[model samples]
Target: MIIQRLDELAEVIEVPLATLNQHYLDTNFKLKVPVHFARQIEKGNLNDPLLRQILPSIDEAKSVKGFSQDPVGDLNANPIDSLLHKYQGRALLITSPQCDIHCRYCFRRHFPYEQAKKRHWQTALEHLASDNSIHEIILSGGDPLTLSETGLLELLRQLEQIPHIETLRIHSRTPVVAPERALKLDWLAALKASRFNVVLVVHCNHPNELSDETKTLFEQYRRADVTLLNQSVLLKGINDSAPILKALSKKLFSQGILPYYCHLLDRVEGASHFEVDDTPAWQIFETLRKELPGYLVPKLVREIAGEPYKTPIIKTL
Candidate 1:
């Protein structure tokens, strides 16, 4: 079940209306939270890290400089109706425009997703076939796994026909936030048998997001020869410190997922409040380096609008 109202959300967690109403922001983005994910929250605690990421905030009304609707230039890079050709050798397919939950800090929160339809996939796939340089296709969205089993399989079949595409990378938050929606058996079978190297990158922010269900689902993916990786946005107060990040990395590793990237919050309008300054961000990274082995340390990076690749934020302030 999805919760779209503050009252419904409050009822799920058993929080009083007065306390919940204080921080709620009724905006066009809307409140969208899955019941399973909502159950993870600590009831009555409005500051819960998971809750902070989704609950529409009054802070979003502030107009901050350097933050924009097209923060990473997604509109500028979009070459076709459903395709975003950003990094070389890899292109992103906007497989679906709907997500199970609406993260307030999402860089694509304001994206014009009306064109992300199955009808547009043919055009995007043709572009992929025409360019041999594009060897990998990242299935991203609001969340690609939101596609039905049939929809996903058919898309995979079409992608398999492209000889030059050697890798099928799926970047989704569904596996972490809504495991039931992502763990389709037919989808897993097709992925295991596919010719392309399959990599599933899940967006998981806090260690609290990991659970037995996620662990079991991840193991299933591992059994299917799918590489499991995770990427997190370094949100201020949510997970800016070394201890929290370290615990997150260890928990991810325990569930067969590697820490791929700890991204600096994209400078998207309304999300500026989540951004951690470079000096403090670098300091946290340095501390993480001391606390964990090299492999466990996620690369701290930021996606600049026109850059060829995600820029590593390694320089000390």
Candidate 2:
């Protein structure tokens, strides 16, 4: 279902109120956890200091400026329900407007999910089906995996019915935030069973997010013949350092996940604090090039509105 409030999600996931309370107290109640991860809550307390470092506080959300509700020009697009066709050939379907964790650097934190749902989604699908140029469909949003197994399966079935669509890509952070959710073998099997070539693009910012459990899930995806790619956002105090980036890239490769795109922060209203200027970002890319092989290095890029492709961050100096 649609989870709007944190409490509603906690109850559905069967997470104990005390456990959530402890996490809140650890993060000083300012840090908000995403609904998907909150659903799989078990036991134990997170290291308060470490939790504070990753989780964003409600107060800190107020401090940052320029992070708008509609970052990446999503609102300007002629959205048909959850589908956004800002770029040609690929359609971004906001299958689920929920995420497993409320990342401090999320550009869509203030997005109007309600408006997204009100638009006629089926019209967008029909548009994709009729277009000969549109070959790929990108499942995005808070996170596509937040949608239930049945929901995702139904969506996939419908997508596969279209004649022009050949590639189905899913961009999600759920596998990192809630590893257990990714362990759903039945869902993996169903995804593999689809007619389209399935690709899973995951977002993993820090090496710490890649745990053994995540590794096992990757192995499952591999066995299901799903091509796995990773994209990370450069965040200050999170993963902007060269060493951290290298380690994260190396770890992802070891798990058969390719290093895809390292995106510059989308200058949303609340995320200015995480934005690393182009100068330093290019330097980090240079450092990575020196340390890692060509294939291992993720392309440093920025998403410009109306552009057909991501703009590569080039060093002119």
Candidate 3:
């Protein structure tokens, strides 16, 4: 079940109706919390890390400098309505226009889903086939896993015909936020038999997001030879602390996932409230490096418009 109303969420988490109403903001990017995720929040605790990431607040209405609707230049990189080829050798397809949850800090919260054209399916496929330089195709969106079994399998079938494509990468939060819906036997079976190397990069912020269901799902994917990895955003008052991030990494590894990228929050207009400043962001990463093995440390990076790759935040003297 999905919770889209403040009153419904308040009832589940035991937060007072009056108190919840004070901070809630009914914006275009409205509330969309999966029941599986919502149950993990600490009842009556408004400051829960998981809750903070999803709950819309009045703070989103603030106008902050250096923030815009298209923070990562997604629109500029979009050659076609359905495809985005930002980084070389890889292309991202908006496989689905919706997600199970609406994270407050999502950089794509303001994305123009209405603009996604049905005709672009063939256009995207033709473009990918013609570009021998592009070896990997990334399935992203709201969440590609949200697509129906038949729809997803059919899309995969088409991509398999592209002789040059060697890898299939899917970036989705579903495996973490809504494991029940994401774990499909048919999809797993298809991925196992696919010629391309399959990597499923799941989005997870806090350690609390990792649960028994996620563990079971990750194991299933692993058995299918799917490389399981996680990426997190460094958000203010969320998973910004060294201790919290450290815990997250340890927990992820325990469940057969690797820490991939710990991104500095994109300066999307409404998500400015979640941004952690450069000084503290670097400091947190430096501390994290000291506490964990090198491989366990996620690369601290930021996405800059027009940059060839994600720029790493190198600590300075």
Candidate 4:
């Protein structure tokens, strides 16, 4: 689908071409919009929250003072080329550089993905085996679920053999963006069959993303041995409102998915527009706290450039 540009999307839905911003569409970053995820957009409605996250806007073309290319310091933490070992006891692996949908605000939009792709995983696995301190492995990237089934299984099987590695965390947008992938993934049970506890972290910004099919997918996970969790980026003009966040939490709870981190947008170059200032961001979280139980309220935090863990924002004031 060439629906990457607002004008292109306008053509598809018969919306006004003049309304689209062409300057930002020229951004060098890759643009991908999967058919399943694109269907969630309201016709002719450019301000649709889902669309806002994926659409390129003029704001993205500006340079915000604090924003930089490697905002989260992925390069600094790259011990082995494909692996990121920022925090102790856990590590993140770039399983692949492919994703089903290209979220405009992705912090890694400007990351040196080519460098990450060139290095194979065997060396990273060896580094893991050498360190008894690290126990959990996080599969991340454009989305690890994008990896071939045979490759994913091989990786999981290898991780399980490492004596100290007790957990395998797979973070992917696949299940939420296209729930059928979750249904068709036959390797989950087998992966769980290994000693490591398997967890799937899904990215969802709105309740609308959790369609009937998505909810059913969650139901399947609940019945299985795998644990399901959701992490939503606190995007401005998206789920910034308290009511929207609360509704998302309630919906997630009802579907057997736990609300995990509600991370403030990383100060990355192009995604500065999505960064909600501290005051309003916390105010929304505070209001959200009043409306939902503690468990349902995800920890609101910021990923400081070189921090070992996500620094939680304990108070709004």
Candidate 5:
């Protein structure tokens, strides 16, 4: 459930709204919630002084230079309204344009969601069915889990019909933003019942986000027989340090989740504040290499437009 008002969420969770508001304010209005789980609570007003810290204001977005509406060549790859085929064996389908919470650093913040919504399962299925080499269908967007259970089930059913589509990967922040959404046993059952192999890619930036509730959600996915992976962004104030990254990876691994990708900030509008330079990113990665096992070291990657795969940041020592 998208709680637009903090009070409403407090009511549901039986916490005081003032307490939640104060938490945001006490943190200098910075995003205190983990990136993975921060999207569920809706801001009543973006201009609310306390809210503006985390929620991007229109003026702030406009002030940023060189931020394009289509940052990562989505326009070029979008063959259908909802489908984007850029990689060899994978096709990306934007299932929903609405997120439970909007992150200030979201790369697709300026994407024309209204236009994309017109392209639904029918349009996406046509694109997926037409390509024989497409072995994986990636569900991404405002967060695909925001879709109703029925909507997701319908999508899964359509995709299952494509024999060539062997894997279905859902990239979502729902488990982080709203643990309640992840607790939906029915949705997990539907995903497991589907014929396609399922993988859930979750986003987590800080260790604080991995509360007991979130860990339980990961276990729920594991029980449902879904492969779990985590992708984190290299953010300036949030998680640029080596210790933070190492701790986050350890916590995720303890929960049976693998650290997948550590992405460089996609130079999107309003998100320039979070960009960590390549040199610093590499230095941090080197530290992580020494501290954590090879498997726990997430590949440092940058998504260049029109590239078949993410470019790994190689360091020459």
Candidate 6:
């Protein structure tokens, strides 16, 4: 998927293919992008915010100081093969590592999918059944929505049996990149019909990522009894501006999705290019708050090495 884009981007932008040599451009993890997302990139523009995300570049292969394989300590927190209990009330399940689009800055890009493989889909379910303390299960990775309706529905049904799991939080970029997946599944309708509190935590970094198509997608999901929230990573050249963040929040609210977290990019080994400094990130959020209602301002936070929860970048005035 990425190989084709590398070539396409090189051709369109007239940047010599040699500039993005295969040795350096091809990160260990392969790029995965759907055609819908590819259309969003501005042809001949290499600096397109959307393009910078999925397009592999020589920079990704460079190692920088402080970046590591397991940035968030995912390996240390795992109690089972596919489950991670980092926070007190929630448990995240790596349902599948198959994502429709591969963002270059993904923190989990270097995640050892093979080591954490689940023998049976029921493996995580059985573990959840035993832990009554866990009240929520976050379905992540590649993207849970990528699963077949039958597979997804079946997983949700099993989760239903785990009485303690009161909330189902799905973290995916599908709503932005592949709104059709959400439209196809009737996600909000199907999940809301179940017993759990369905929360779709979508990933949208720029306001531009939200379009008329995605807006309608959110409306359809909102029509159902599901909660919609958005989380964005503060990227260097993409959304480092206060105006961008404010616009993103407003756009999200218009679509019935609240601005949730504006994360300082994780210090993943290959994604150092996206990092925004803590001071600037804090200032950006502060400026953003003055222009918008408090509710619309997303909390600016970072995931430090061993923190149980996200560390807020600044103390709000």
Of the candidates shown, which would achieve the greatest lDDT relative to the real structure? Answer: 3
- Across 1-317, the per-residue lDDT of candidate 2 in tens digits comes to 23435456446545555554544323322344544444333323332322333444343446555556567787777557677887778888887766766676677767777665524557777877878888999988778888788777778888889988999999998887677776766778887787888999998887766777788889999988999999999977667889999999999999889999999988776567677889988898899999999888999999877777889999966
Once fitted onto the true fold, the runs of candidate 5 whose alpha carbons sit more than 4 angstroms away are 1-53, 57-64
Question: What is the number of backbone collisions in each predicted candidate, taken in the order shown?
Answer: 0, 6, 0, 0, 3, 0
Off by over 4 Å in 1: none
Q: Write the per-residue lDDT of candidate 5 for residues 1-317, one digit (tens) a residue.
A: 44445555445444466655654322111233333343322334332322332433333434577666577898889887788889999999988887766666778877877777834669779878888999999999878988888788778888888999999999998786677775767778987787878999998787766777888888889988999999988888778899999999999999889999999989886667678889999999999999899999999999999888999998854
Model 2, which residues run further than 4 Å from truth? 1-31, 34-54, 58-67
Clashing pairs in 5: 37-176, 37-177, 39-101
lDDT (10s digit) by residue, model 3, range 1-317? 89998889999999998999899888999999999999999999999999998899999999999999999999999899999999989999988889999999999989998787445788999989999999999999989988899988999999999999999999999999999998899999999999989999999999999899999999999999999889999999998899999999999999999999999999998888898988899998889888899989999999999999999998764
Candidate 4 lDDT by residue in tens digits, 1-317: 32455555666645577765543466777556665567777777878888787767778888889999988888899898899999999999998987777888999988777877825688989989999999899999978877777878888788888999998898988888877765645576676466878888999989878888888887776665778898999998899999999999988888888999999998898898888988998899889888888999999999997887999986657
> Which stretches of model 6 miss by more than 4 angstroms?
1-5, 8-24, 186-188, 315-317
Cand. 5 Cα-lDDT: 0.76
Task: Name the weakest run of 10 consecutive residues (lDDT summed) in model 3.
Answer: 113-122
Question: TM-scores of the models, in the given order?
Answer: 0.98, 0.83, 0.98, 0.94, 0.84, 0.92
All candidates' lDDT scores?
0.92, 0.74, 0.93, 0.82, 0.76, 0.80
Q: For candidate 2, report its TM-score.
A: 0.83
Which is the winner by TM-score between candidate 4 and candidate 6? 4
Name the weakest run of 10 consecutive residues (lDDT summed) in model 5. 25-34
Count backbone overlaps in model 4.
0
Sort order, lDDT high to low: 3, 1, 4, 6, 5, 2
Comparing 3 with 6 on TM-score, the higher-scoring candidate is 3
